[model samples]
Target: MPGLAGTERKNIAPGLAVSIVLKQDQRTGKLTEGVVKDILTKSPHHPHGIKVRLETGEVGRVKEIHDEE
Candidate 1:
């Protein structure tokens, strides 16, 4: 599937491209795209979104995952 990454812990992995909402941007719902550097959320699922750190060192909650074509 293309661009199908989700909030489930299993859906996110290191190196995958994804869009995330930084803590500061939650109100505006801005999405930042980057490769997954680390998965910060340890739960199986999250209502808002799984927290992750991008390769650029920006930390945020996964809002949308980008599919690498």
Candidate 2:
């Protein structure tokens, strides 16, 4: 718990439950379930998208966000 001192984070504003699709192969349409671990934003010149870290340790980008139920 060395880094736990300042690791406390508050709830994200406008946050809601969301389900992301994890596609292993978009060509074949193969996909799996994913859990959003963190949301990362890119620089202004680095394109535009939200990076999501799945519970399965898979990291990818999503063009848009969706609400689930």
Residue ranges of candidate 1 with Cα displaced over 4 Å:
1-5
Mark the 10 consecutive residues where model 2 has the least summed lDDT: 4-13
Q: RMSD in angstroms, candidate 1?
A: 1.9
lDDT for each of the candidates? 0.88, 0.39
lDDT of 1 by residue, 1-69 (tens): 245556788988999989899999999999899999999999989989899999999999988887677
Candidate 2 stretches greater than 4 Å from native = 1-32, 42-48
The TM-score that candidate 1 achieves is 0.90
Q: How do the predictions measure up, each by TM-score?
A: 0.90, 0.39
The CA lDDT at 59 in model 1 is 98
Error of 1 at 37 (Å): 0.5
Model 2 reaches what TM-score against the true structure?
0.39
